[model samples]
Target: MTKSLKTLLQTMPKPLFGMGAALGLLLFLMVGIAGGFWLFDRYNSPPLGILESLSEEVLDRDGNLLRAFTTDEDRWRLKADLDAVDPEFIDILLAYEDKRFFSHHGIDPLAVLRASWQLLSNREIISGASTISMQLARLIEPREKRTFTAKFWQMARAIQLEQRMSKREILSAYLTLAPYGGNLEGIRAASLAYFAKEPTDLSLEQAALLVALPQSPEARRPDLYPDRARRARDKVLERMAQSGTIAQSEVARASGHPLSAKRHDMPQLAAHTADRLRRQAPKDSVHQTTLNADLQQRMEAVVRDGADRLGTRLSAALVLADAKTGDILAEVGSPDYVSPARSGWIDMSRALRSPGSALKPFIYGLAFEEGLVRSQTIITDQPVNFSGYRPKNFDMDYQGDVSIHDALLLSLNVPAVALLDAVGPARLMERLRSGGVTTELPEGGDVGLAIGLGGLGITLKDLTQLYTTFANRGHSTILTDQPRSSAERQADASASPIPVLDPVASWHVSGILKDASPPRGAPNLPIAYKTGTSYGYRDAWSVGFDGRYVIGVWVGRADNSAVPGITGRTAAAPILFEAFSRSGLSLSPLPSKPYGAQEQTLAELPPTLRRFEISKSWLTNDSLPEPAPKIDYPPRGAQIEMTRTASGQVLPVLVKLQDGRPPFRWLVNGKVLQANGNRRKVAWQPSGAGLSTLTVIDSAGRADSVSIYLTLP
Candidate 1:
């Protein structure tokens, strides 16, 4: 301590030292206030428990509502955001609930002062000073009673919320958690329930009514007390007009609007689809599907109508899809969703059922691709045994020899089985699997000719996909229920493409089936379709396609029981045509012929293709040799009478042959009645009633002739 230093310190004023101590104390106090605020904010943060209880929604491709599941508490707490609500509703809310909602941090002092003054001057609590943020705080941390303590806590939490979140966030929270009436929490839920629409497009009157409901949810419930709700809504309109939130004339018009008398039922279209999607998505998340609600409704109607006409215990499933994109446009799992008699709850579209003759087209297509047969190629439809496993046609009779086009158009069983044998069943199964179809073969059973006739099990969805590949020019893509995102689409584009069949083969099959006669009385459609009836009539199916769309239909007893007289041509083909008609799309023509394809008649085809020949070894080594030529009909020297009707129609004589090679020639009275007859039977129109000689010649040069006298009736 130097003497100079001591003198300088002693000259300092006592007031200056006192001021320094006061400043130090003020700095400490400031630090303490900030520390207390930080601690309070950390402890008083808004709870987000309400957000976890939001309702889950399933939407269509256009974001239209499909279905929504309520919270565990049975509350309709659909998620809401500031952008999703009508601006008019927000305006009315702020003007009526808290005018200074945007400018004030959390609490409005002027509003508090005004409320306090009114309470004191009137000796009653007439108005509330709680801003929207304060209300949000109370909503998140609900309290049973409105006490001074609760109000103070709410104000503190609101201040903390204002510091932590943006104005829009706070407003969204309020909109999402606000109560409307029983079991309706958010604006979206209330809007859907009361008005049967979205909150994003509400009228002024609807907006006012929604704004008023949150103030006194129970007392102002429109469904329970329409008059009280009208009054509350008008009060909101009055405030909105006074605050200039809306024009006075608009207010008058809004006030004159009526309140909703009852709640509306939520959207229930595509209920099964929504349920399936919800099971696959995360809880409380939104799911969007590629289903078209309108199309789905129409398909359901079609299936239901078909099922009704088919009688009891019968169900129908249908699927419609975009051929190019493989997007499932509509799916009907069953005709009626609640009919126990029909087992309607089961999703039959995904169920494994025998496809019957529905698969014959693919076999024929494969044959065409292999160059083993053509549309104009002649095929034998006579009774034939393959290793002792004989296949009989549905009618228990065969047209002895027919062109490939006629065979496929008639859906002949023998020709299809013979073709399947030629193409090898294993190859057909492999082709189907490569095309994204799942075929269920019997355990350890070899691929056999029966598979060509639908011995194997396949779902309608997979079958539809397989047919869609034909419409898509023989390329196959996976079908999707939901629209893919851009990234997913890109990834799919990078994946290797799957080829189902050659383009020419697919086109040939489509061309042949397109000309097949439609079901009786069905309007002619430029579509390629096939009908199938499984063994014992257990399942009936019809799959059809054009250039743009493919539809598959299944009708049967869900229990796999046989339904008598239920064949594909009768029960399913009509439904298939009706489905196309109800789809509301113009019929698309079949794709243009592939470059290598050329239409020709059987006589114009090459010699080898003019007749389908399989080696005796392919059939069986135990088979007997070709029988000598013989004529069984117009038996040797028998008199046959030719009849003419009143309309002057001449009747023909029937010529039948047995145990002979094909390409047989017939002669009547030395005049050739038929040249190169390929069947066991032929009809000859008698020129006159006289002695007629019928002669038959086999391709091997063996000849048999029967002469008979034709007498006029």
Candidate 2:
């Protein structure tokens, strides 16, 4: 009752009346505007609207660029309107969402009034009586937030849409726009995802399941809530029967039917393959990958089953190709894959890892084909110390004086390194790159030995592709997974021979490599293979070819850490054998050629070395051939020594046969030794490490003949 309070009341009264009047006027204007828009939209909106856009593209396996797109995402959307929806689903959806749909127009005034009365009575808004048109409107114009304003817009849009399109069109839009579950935006995606078939292909029970999903897609995911979904499906059947949408027996059959939703457990094999393809075709728009469902499943089964038996933390990768065409047939990346329900990470295919000695055969074969060295050439197997790089033979022992054939057969590191040195790392790396190896080679000059030893990192895809050259007779071809046609067949048949390398040389190298891998118990089918072991046992690989298929198997831990004590022969060869065995190739032997097949000589031999000719009987015998004896010469001179091969013992006799007269002088520790009385004998003692030598002197004072000892340990 103070003066300020009285003044505030007076100020509030005058404006309050005016404000109320203005508010009433604004409400009236809004209602009038809304009403006019509704009437105009309902009466004037176009009927039988023309199609706006549509297109579809079909691609060949090579991504050879085919077709144009229609309506963005739907190249193959065969629309099934309301009349086409399996009658059971329509009944379930109508019974659950809107029992009065058929009885109402675009909006149900009674349901709206009922909803308002419930809200006024403080009851939860458990049900929405949106007619089919309203549902279609919400689908066409999705909103970020669900508010009263959104419902108002939906109602207005519904009336306009109903005038513009037929009931069938509205229902079709709803079916496609309806959200079912993850990756299932519409009835079609859900139908295929859950039932492994299309909407038209769904069974009665499946149709019920789809219709039940709109209530709660996640809570009733067929994969997650089989029981709940089944019960909801039964309710749908009952409602259909009660509503006379279907006969009593029909309802009984559907309600009592089992919910046979196809098992949606992530297909381990397919998912793994898709992951690999995704990596390979990241920007390819569409990935027409070479994945044979049957082959992939078989490979998965083998890897999973084999890993279990091996007792090691084992995993495997398998790639199959058409040997003639270089087309990949199948690929399995891993045993485990990513999924909403699963909890592990494994990307086995593209995971870069070391492919130990697996690269050896290709390298050695390429070297041989290039004529860097011959198979029979005597490559020293003795310990080699080149600069600071010293590689050891696998046995940790050197085999001295081995033929190149023996060295390669044993995969002796020194012989391979020697060949690499002869071929030059740069040239060899270029050959590998040309053969399809997309890997980083070690610095050619610095780490040439490392590359020779399989120290480079490479992905399984590239590794497999590189081996295709060997399988394809040293020709590179584009590999893919699309379907082949008769025209393509004729083109390939008429295509020119793949040009790159000498067929004879490549085949010879391949033959040698094939023999090198002597299968342990049962010989692996006539396979030309090379195995590799990287430092720290970080990787193991066995890439080879049977008569028809080229195989590459790489095994290692996923973390890029070393698998202690595992080598390529141990880890990957067995898997290769298994794959080859399953492929039905026989263990037949390949043709063999003589060592140094390209190099042989029939020319006359070089002249023999004999500095002095001598005879016996100087002391005892009466008759003997006289010796062209030795002569003394310069004060400081070199001496010749001869020794036998078996024992390091020196011989005392000098030979008469020589290119010219012997000018050799005999010297023992700086003193001139006299030729014996027989003239044939010269005093020579064992010296140096193994054997001694006798020197013969000629009239010119030049040493005529010297023979050095070659002792065998």
Candidate 3:
């Protein structure tokens, strides 16, 4: 063996032995500490759940605060994050409290020694040596008095906190627990209360004020004692200068900055909506909604003014949104959400009330689609009866041989009911519901023509949603305020799944309504609008829409008491117009006229279409007065949620027939499913997603189909 190799081998063992011995000792110490902590974990552990107790927040689409609810303790304590806080504030806080915060484990020996010396020399407690961790322990489990025994217990808890959490976590909890005056327990609440802003960005004066308030919150309340508060803040600024946390040149400027003595009220926009979301998800700490806070505030003011001017006991609600996406931008549930006398706590926008003639446009639009009439088609607007149901005009007079445009604009009840009879009432409501408009007939009521003229109860929201079909030029979107909902899933479910009318027909209908006369003294905005009054003046509604916006207003008493002289035009239309004017959005141009839309005089039109003849044109194609082979279970424009099996296969869609001859044939997406099956029900498995047209044909070859969207829940 070489002499050098032997010498190296002799020294390697000693070095290896020393390294192994050190690692073994370290492992043994860790095991011993783990055993000790396992015993310590049984009691006196930190209350970690306290960190999770936070205020419930409601924020608008742009993260602007709309409202917030205090915790059960009646304290506004929002979770604090180091990233969301101003770094300058952190620097000022640390410099004033614990300079060796980051370097120490839990307690700083230097600080303890200095505090001890100062106490001994002065024969009294001169200064505190509590690190951020120790302060956090006291905040979590506060002591009744500042005795030496309590201090030792706080020191113990401080060590536990340091062992259990990171330095950043400890500091964040401290920031969150730091008490400000008047039930504000966090930097966020304090900032919003005093400065009407967030803690994310702070001025030097603002940071100093915040840093000094937690020391003596009540005594230094800026709103209660401005002089003491100012002195306390200035002292913090002076300390920052002395410690060089902030430049000496900045102290005078910060001190000269004035402090706000008045406390701003927390935002209270969309009170009803916030309450709704809070009830929906009681445990959620934050609810992000698709609302514009500023617009909601302004809209509420408009509602408040309208209700106030209408005198006592009359409350109004306004609902508006982006027509294309159906994102509700503003909803004023009541004029004064807290008014006890008016029962304004109720959300009138979602309450069921008679729509009156507000639903007439949808009927007319459907008629135009079915080739029953055109904009200029002449129709008799006289008293009419369908079986036992007789309807008269709202003014108790009839227009002889009036154009469809005039009939609709006048909201003649007879003409509307006449058209509804020609086209099935069930069909009209089906189309409305297909477009996401919720309507309800009286209990045990059958489908009838009276529904065309305020015969059913509908919410203002559903009424406004129906107008979106006209605003979007035939397509409809479901209104929602939830941002987390999948818009793409709803839109991509099908190709115009809920079409109210064809583009050409919707254009004709919207054009006629666009010429509707404005309420007295209201601006002649480029929008198509209609108004309605319930049978007994219990509800008045007005819904209008431009190209991109749809707004609806309701004026009535919550108790459903009729108010004399309250008409749609006089009570609701004014509020609707005011909403548009105050919406803070410029009107978008109405949809362009469709290519197939053409104006024709009676003489130039097809002989059948020259006059009102609904049964002759659309029904003639099938050569039947009534359609047969009806699919009943899954209604038109219905969305069926299919379950997936463990094998990842979608369940089959069940189809039922209301009336059909025996030995029926079923087809799905034009593919034969059940051939010559006598049973009324059948199942069809879809190959993919999107709109599926399910058709059933009876022995007589009379066929009917219903379109539905296939989705998974």
Candidate 4:
């Protein structure tokens, strides 16, 4: 074997043996490079956590920018959505920065060789071989100094980034983190700042300008150095033209385009609402709201314009929503979010305030539902005293013997209070709370007749939700601003909603309210609305609804200071009318009268509903039609011990009625308890050990009440 090996070696060609040796050395070099890369990757991973540090954004339902907040470092860095960005911009960016971005792994060797040659020929550094991935590494972990050591680590990190992320993700990171002068970063910030528009559809010249800015952001900022910025953009266009990526004609046209020397502010809509939701969930990067950007913009303008007419220290708010689904489309928290005198920082839409006559519709709705009154049923609007609680008309005058329809249309306080005195106040509050209303009541939260005349507290948001029920034919849904998936949003427009009234009674309410006069000289739109003014002119409210939309407006001083002489019809109703017109929607007619509901004239109704009369004190009548209700058991000022069963359940106290009409309803502490008809008795479980008021309302709209103390046994 030794002799044969010697013979073969002696006979082998020298060039072939040298060739084998070279191949072995090359293989050894390749393995060493692979081992080095593996170790580098294991020890120094790319700072991929920077991806999570993007600015929080709030967008409308269509993914349009509504508002955005800066990052922890106070930089305007937004994510670049490739689908929304123009594709031509991406091509121009690649042609100028890294032509071989798609083919190369992390670095382009040919470009590096060309740069080396140029540096040697010119005796100065000319260019560097930085790919998109390398640029992304530098952006996430920027180094102020330029050195070989820094370059080496940057190259290593680039390789790591490519291994961990896809090519598209790497390019997206570059687009998101690339600096564009001052605190502005990302393609989105650049476009919005310089162009005052989205990056979705960039012109040829604009695209080239954005492509050139990130290379030397501060030096080429158009707002700071217009000449340098233009030169840089022309350089990019020249390169694109030479590479056959763009036509020379296009290059010439783009070269002459002007650049703005000013920076514009980014979109800042829905300020109060966006701040609230962002604070609620800080970690969420994107919040999709139910707001309509176009409608929101229009409504904001309306509020700002109306602020001037409201005089000093006065502010306004409005909430517009879908009647059927209760999705809040446009909500203005206040006229100016930063105004000092108006206390504009306080979101008036959510702040509790007096609703005034805005709730009169609910009172009339309950009356019609209980068969106590018809549209044509006559009820006296004269001044009345209820157990020392006196309520008068808003104008301080009364109309004698008016039909129910006219009484509601006028929003007469006397008629409303009389109706509320018939129905329990507790019943109205509970009905409101069921539909997500936060009712704020005074005097221990157990209300009196004053509640029927803006005595209770409520927010514009809750008030709007209540009016949405009247428009939806008595069905009510909770108002929501958070956007849902398309499938989810359209799924249950007619699901089981909270029933504010039966269809028949709701139609009767709408039937009477549609005739309420609109703002003076305003277009007579197909809508049903009510206006209200609180006592002392503190809050003015107007809420109206077409077939498709419901809007509520409030004009007042946020500090709760009275702005005298500001009535709802003059201040708020005009705004409400304008909001619907600016909504970009044609007013839809109110719902047709539902089945089993027909307009009735006087003498066409039943005897009980013909005239709602419990007492005629103003008449010269010695004979009364019926006696007022009386609470016999648990007499007024009576204190009784509460009993409990063995199972830790409190026993209910029984209430007996006397000397009234049949079909009686009972109330305890202004809240209605379980009532029985014709039996004259009710069983009530006392809420706790305390003094409580118990009242009884007969079918004739006459009430008798008593106060009792239940002591714990």
What Cα-based lDDT does every candidate model obtain? 0.83, 0.57, 0.83, 0.82
- Compared with the true structure, model 2 gives a TM-score of 0.54
Deviation from truth (RMSD, Å), model 1: 13.7
Candidate 4 lands at a TM-score of: 0.82
Top candidate on TM-score is 4
Give candidate 3 regions above 4 Å deviation.
1-38, 485-488, 491-496, 601-603, 613-713
Candidate 1: stretches off by over 4 Å: 1-34, 282-284, 486-498, 517-523, 614-713
> For each predicted model, how many residue pairs clash, with residues at least 3 apart or on different chains?
0, 26, 0, 0
- Candidate 2 local distance difference test against the native: 0.57
Name the 10 consecutive residues with the lowest summed lDDT in model 1.
Answer: 640-649
Q: Could you give candidate 2's per-residue lDDT for residues 328-431 as a string of tens digits?
A: 66665654444211121565666677665556655566566665545555556754555545566654456777655667778888667666765667666666
Please identify which of the two predictions, 1 or 3, would achieve the higher TM-score against the true structure.
1
Lowest lDDT sum, 10 consecutive residues, model 2, at 609-618
Candidate 3: the clashing residue pairs are none
Clashes in candidate 3: how many? Answer: 0
Which 10 consecutive residues of model 3 have the lowest summed lDDT? 615-624
User: How does each model score on TM-score?
Assistant: 0.79, 0.54, 0.78, 0.82
Rank ordering of all candidates by TM-score, starting from the highest: 4, 1, 3, 2
